[model samples]
Target: MAISNVLMFGMVDFSGLLDKFGIDWHLLLIQSLNFVLVAFLLYRFGFRSVARVMDERREKIELGLKYADDMKREKAAFESSRAQRAESARREAEGIVKSAKDGAKAILEQGKMELQQQSAGMILNAEKEIARRRKKILGDAKAEIGTLVVEVAKSVLASQMTDRDRNNYAAMAEKMLP
Candidate 1:
């Protein structure tokens, strides 16, 4: 009740000031009504459309931001997948190279063994040929030495021999020739 009395007292003083200023209540009420009508028309016709457009723009901006974030995540996932594939390819390439090296080594070893076998076979064949040739040469030399000894004995015995002595010496030489 006291607060109401105080508010009424302030209103009385304010009304007296307004009267002194020649502020007519009827003119004030008409102006207030005009202002309210203008404000309502402006809010309904202009501000509502502007607010709707702003809301649409805000939604579009949010969608664009969400799309950008999704794209970033997708790019990160793609990069991770690509890196893993690259690592796998590297390992596969290394494995292929290692296998190739091992295969090459095996081939080289096989070739070396084959070459050694061929060389050993060739050496054995050459040794056999040499031994055969040596044996043939020794036989030929022995035959030639025997023929020379018989011819030398014949010449020496022929120079001093009668037919009877020749026959006896030839029989003895034939017995001793070998």
Candidate 2:
């Protein structure tokens, strides 16, 4: 029974209810027109300007975000380039040091060669000087021995021969001794 009554109430005519409530159709129509006019004015003057301002703010924010991203990428690139330059410099330094070491080694080897050559030349000069000295000593000794033999022959013949014989013997001795 309650459900039947609720359904019957829902079917009641709305025009009879409006009349009972003292609602006028002309007033309702005028109020509806007023609401529509007010909504259109607010949307045209107030809402449109506010929307424009919001759109401008949104664009600014997007541009700022894009600029920040670009800056971040640039910073990363700069850091990478700096690291590469540092690595290149380190390698160049290593190459320079290696070159210097090689140069030093070459110079050292050249010095050793020169020293060896100088030592060999000195030894050869010393040998030549020793040979010259030995020859000089031998010549002096032979001259000394020849002089002693001539003196001994003169002394031995002086005791056993006459003056002329001794003179001839001395002359022969002198020639034979030489």
Candidate 3:
């Protein structure tokens, strides 16, 4: 097998092709060397610049991620503060409503007291007016009774004088003597 591989390598006939084409092996070797040198130079200069730009882009992406995190925290804080203010406003509104309710209750009580006082005053005035009217009626009735007694006494005296004659008056006068 080694013999056959060596024979195959030797019978390749690359020199005949190069001779027919008037190509120099040494010039080919030099051109190959030049290509390797140009590739190395491009790798050192061009590839390094591209790698630097890529590194800068990666750093900018990291910074943007950090900025986004900070914005999220700020938004959370703003929402918390807004919630606190809303609670405070709700408490204040409740207090105001309670105070208004209390005030209304107080006003209602005061009005009731005033109404009671007015009612009592009116009752007292009515009682006083009724008593005055009763007293006036009694006084008028007593005056009428006194006038009737005086007229009855006068009629009795006139009847007794008309029934008696002058002789009966003298006899009654004698009988009345002590």
Candidate 4:
């Protein structure tokens, strides 16, 4: 076939050159088929494997990201629970301290009450002892006064009486006897 009428551009035509080089349509068709076959083979052998590896790597990255997110959520939950527990423990400790303080105050008050009661009882016992001692002293003084009066009367009568007076006194005393 003549390539002279196949103008590549408006001024380029090389029919004689193509005939001299023996280039034909069949050769072009075979070269195009070979290029297509080689491209398909390279795509199947190299690019497909590389793309599959890249896809697997991407999937792993996504999975790692998801796992990291899950771990973060778990850590946050743990911290929240820990904080709540700490708060609860603090409240409980405060309550315990308050209770202890109240108990101590109550005990102190009870001790004061007991001390007052004991002191009052001691004072009462002391007063009773004083009264008893006073009564005893008064009784002893009265006994001593009585004894002194008896002795004085005996002495006075003995000094004033005589033998004749004693005999008349006995006669008067016998007539007056009931």
* Rank list by TM-score: 1, 4, 2, 3
In terms of TM-score, which candidate is stronger, 1 or 3? 1
Per-prediction count of colliding residue pairs?
A: 0, 0, 0, 0
Q: Runs in model 3 with CA error above 4 Å? A: 1-63, 136-178
lDDT of 1 by residue, 13-93 (tens): 999999899999899999999999999999899998999999999999999999999999999999999999999999999
Positional deviation of 76 in candidate 3, in angstroms? Answer: 2.0
Error of 3 at 83 (Å): 2.1
What C-alpha lDDT do the candidate models reach, one value each?
0.86, 0.82, 0.75, 0.79
TM-score of each: 0.61, 0.55, 0.48, 0.58
Best by TM-score: 1
Q: Where is model 4 more than 4 Å wrong at Cα?
A: 1-45, 140-178
Question: How many clashing residue pairs, candidate 2?
Answer: 0
- Tens-digit lDDT track for model 2 on 1-178? 9998887876575657877897998999999999999999999999999999999999999999999999999999999999999999999999999999999999999999999999999999999889988777766755665456546765765566566765565456546643
Per residue, candidate 4 scores C-alpha lDDT tens digits across 12-107 of 446667777898999999999999999999999999999999999999999999999999999999999999999999999999999999999999
Better of 1 and 2 by TM-score: 1
TM-score of 3: 0.48
Ranking the candidates on lDDT from highest down gives 1, 2, 4, 3
Q: TM-score: which is higher, 3 or 4?
A: 4
